[model samples]
Target: MSTAKPSQFGVAGLGVMGVNLALNIADHGFSVAGWEFSPKRLAAVQAEKPYERLKTTGSLEEFVGMLERPRRILLMVTAGDPVDQMMDRLAPLLSPGDVLIDGGNSWFQDTQRREKAYREKGLRFIGMGVSGGEEGARHGPSLMPGGPAEAYEHIRPVVEAIAAKTDQGACVTHVGPGGAGHFVKMVHNGIEYADMQLLAETYDVLRRGLGLSPDALVNTLAEWNEGISGSFLLETTLQVLRKKDPETGKPLVDLVLDKAGQKGTGKWTVQVSLDLGVPVPSIASALDARNLSAMKDERVAASAKLPAPQAALTDEEKQHLAAWTHDALYAARVVTYAQGMRLIQAASKEYQWNVSLAELARIWRGGCIIRAKLLTPLREAFTQQPDLPNLVVSEAFAPVLTRMAPAWRRVVGTATRLGIPVPVFSSSLAYLDSYRSAELPQNLTQAQRDAFGAHTYQRRDRPEAGFVHSDWS
Candidate 1:
């Protein structure tokens, strides 16, 4: 008789994320079996002996065999082709009712298709969005899982056990069915891009306009973090600013290249938003900023020919710049999140996901990269009105925005006068302004389209008439 015991959970693709997750599962007293195609990775994990309850194998078959029946597996591989290849290989080995989770930043449509295909094969496919980086994985991460309800039930215990916990509860949820999890995660990344860009812009303005040193900047941000502006990214920024290069003994961030890198999620968010007819200009602008940053050489060359505005801040502007920027940062951040949430809402309605924005807010309160203090009231706003048309108009935020609009405008105006680029700030403010306005210049746009192309327009007086064309000859 064999004296072997089957693992409760299985993980394929033992990369950094996979190994840490496996270890996390083991730490929670679940026997975990990990499969790695790379012998080097397998050997390294085995040598580490991080957990006695965890086992690693290079053989996929052995890895599957060692897992308990109706096996629960997590595929932490690169998104796209790798996920499909692994699914194909695992299909023959998995029994009916087995569950497989794709724990990557995958395209939501891909997840939807994979779920359908797996269901046809009598297996359950879950598109799970695991947020927080390596450290979060080893400790805890916010988990967003969307799949068959029963399938979620199967792995819920393991996930909930390993997920980041807040005062409310675990940072995990059954987001919805199909690709809802990935969709939400995509928007989360989009919001992350905007928030990061907002921070970068703030840093640039404060550093250049105010002549604040790194230490001074840290102090300002630290004070902000103690209030509603507190966030994982802000804290990380402070840490980065505090870091000194060992070799040069200078602020490490200053020595680093100005170029930014991305992994396509931000672009996907913008693309999907357009498809769903949801405007996310803040996120769009952030994506554009990254694209523009990539052309550093071009920018350097253009700087010589293109002259910047030579305006300087007045005494009044000097005294209130930081205060105004603080308001702009908070207000713009709210708008950025509003855009992301609205995008999610549109997708939810389009796909019938029934995702609770409140639950998402709760889960995002900790662990995730975009975790912020604002999520609390944001959650409450959704709870109070599940069908909130826009977060800017939410009861909790409307007054705050009204109060802060003056300062936000001041920040934008000051930045503009100094020739500082604040794309997200300006775009987000425009989004807010457009949302608040009952009448817009789009009436002229309609007339122009109708005059040139005979594209019909709807009249305010007779909306029942529908599609009326005007002749301007």
Candidate 2:
């Protein structure tokens, strides 16, 4: 019952990402109808000649008229509530077979709800995860689409052509049904937060603790970027520190706004981890760091921030702090990335989506928001063992961590003695220890679950259980 035609698509919202994506689609020879609420924005887009054959429509009806039934509309609007607003405005004007694609960092739950509602109208909806940032939007991105299998077919060619590719081919694929695409994107953001916090903490230790200059810190970071810890986030942090303010000749980062703004996916990642019964302390710490960053001004004014007393650092102490922080950062990064991949795996399993974890990793190897060369090994690791707990736990990663563990411990102990906050790093080390723990009290959890929900329990001695518990005195 679909009515989509080839070479017809529409990009709604003329934000930077949307405009670039529109240009990308148009460059692929697809006729696109670009819609924007602002006349100025509409004119600006027109002025850019993003697409030579592009059409501009002020009316929703005219935009719909540009395509056949099952129209393809990509919503490049803001995440959360704005997505719902756009859908409400667009739904009534579309026909039964139309398709709505959300290219924002929307909550996966919202995507699921929207898809259900759209289904009732005999329309289709897709929750798509697109990374590679603004630059990638103009050239290529890592695209993850989740929804009807049939709907994917109509858009696959364009998605493939516009996604970052590996040695094999294009990087895009149908992620899975429901909200898997958005869910995966949330994990990506969470991992991003962890990665950023690790590098920041490293900078703090080197600067305040070791009295290294910004240039030194940048040098150290660049070195890390060359190894397993090497990734897009670390590389970018180095670049940011390299930026100097022309006005005062100070680092632009020092004067740039203190309150770091986020689009909420990182918070959602930690929240979802809690709900899913996953231990994501590293990710949680990263989330807490973001929250704390927002309160920087308030914290500074509170009794001059009541800075903690400094401790004398012995050679051993300095060495330990450096080592421990390294391990923690390295381990935490692995956990956060693994947690994201696991989330994607769970979503794919739960929704019957055939998303290729390997392919997703490959897409991340280049032009997308989270792109980094490290993804090559990650993609390869997954290909070898799809059920890996994390990249850190893999045989390939063991030697790397083993070499890095001593440094990680030193850094952690030094931070502990100095009362320096390193939540993400500490949480990552904690996660590593917990994962490698030989025994956990699962029996107690089972007992609690049975007590609350009358859930069945399995006894150690017997396959079928007479539920029992021993009270610890």
Candidate 3:
């Protein structure tokens, strides 16, 4: 077991994502040491499974001791408080040049704090955003690593080598300093929320309007995956839909619950967008859907208690509704990604993240849940112009929106008329239209910001950096 300076990789947490990433590292030929608090959890690693390269250490001290000098460890633990626990325990034990990588759904502010804390200990802290979910963790993850360039140098080879690769190459890249990676990841998740919302709306239309079974929907999704709409998440959604229900004769997806659950990342995405003065309406609406789903009991009661139209729907109207919904979902989904990328581009300028949007799109294409083949053109567009303001105006994507907008509009009109809550998709289209319009009703908003903060604002007449202060009292 003791080879002269064998490259050792250790994962500190044994949670689902952690376990899968550890397995991936081991599966890819790197020697791995995994540390978990519970012996019972460690027993699962010992169990006869496909990946055997992982060796569980008895204690935290022991795990830290196993790695060679300039040790590299990835903390795949839950984000927030628990991250500090690992740092506190290991900072003393780790050498000056050792690296501690955080690969979790942590806030960018937290990443900055942790990186600063670890730097004082002389142990480099890498704030990395590791995406691709469970399967990607076990196969190829799209990794965004940010920290000291030296620390990145030590770990980049391992990370890039193990990351998910396209036919062209690896999905991993150095995102930038401190919180940049996590910030980028946060935006990525926000975009994902909007994308999934669109897909769900499309599914609703297909099911309600076309009278398509889950199997039929799966077929449609699969076909879409082959075209410009193609993506890893889309491909998987088809798989999830095609699965048969265990208790019933229908598709498993049909039998499954409708409500979607969310972790904090999506919320963070919306919050960050707000803080940055960036509009992510589609993402916000998607988050709202999950929030509404969580309020099912209240919503159900409201439906029951409120005076509502308890009427039957006509078949023709239903078909029209579905057809309209599909188009709306597509347009909204595209706009959501556009907004998310724009937010990141704005941040890149502010924070000096030096992020490569092309690599980001490519990395997202495979490992992440929102991945799709449409990302290839996105990646290419970004590569050509690293600081492109928005994915909406990208030459490759513009034509798509131009062609689809009319259809998308028709769908939105039909859904609204039918009283369907196509929030994610509809909200996206709304925001898109508003964004393109030269005029926006911002007088009220500016009045409010000025009223409270007395924040300086430029006069519309002069349009200069000079402020026009208002005395509200």
- TM-score to native of every candidate shown: 0.99, 0.88, 0.90
Provide backbone clash counts, one per model. Answer: 0, 24, 5
Best by TM-score: 1
**Evaluation by TM-score, superior candidate among 1 and 2:** 1
Worst ten-residue run, lDDT, model 1?
47-56
Q: Residue 103 in model 3: shift from native, Å?
A: 1.2
Name the candidate that leads on lDDT. 1
User: Superposing every Cα of model 2 onto the true structure, what RMSD results?
Assistant: 4.0
In angstroms, what RMSD does candidate 3 have relative to the true structure? 3.2
lDDT of 2 by residue, 1-473 (tens): 54534338888998899989988888877778878888888888777744556777677766777774568899998887888888999888988888899999888888999999999988899999888888789888888788888888877877887777677578787777888788877887787877778888887777767777888778777776786666777778888999999988998887876576777888888788777777677777877887888997787897376777678678865555544555556665666677678767766666676667887787667665566655777788889988765677777666766777667767777777776777877777767666767877887888788777777577777866576544433
Candidate 3 overall lDDT versus native: 0.79
lDDT of 3 by residue, 1-473 (tens): 55635348889988788888888888778888888987887777667484556777659988887777779999988888889988998888988999999999889989988898888877899989888888888888888888888889998878977888878678887888889899998998888887877777787756654567887777767766776677666777888887886677677776666678988888998888888898888889989988888887788888767754334356655546544544555566678888988888878778887878887887776666777766788789888887777878888877778878877876665555545567876787788778778988787788778888997566778886587778777
Tell me the spans in candidate 3 whose CA falls farther than 4 Å from its real position.
1-7, 50-52, 305-327, 443-473
TM-score of 2: 0.88
Give the Cα lDDT of each candidate. Answer: 0.95, 0.77, 0.79
lDDT of 1 at 348: 95
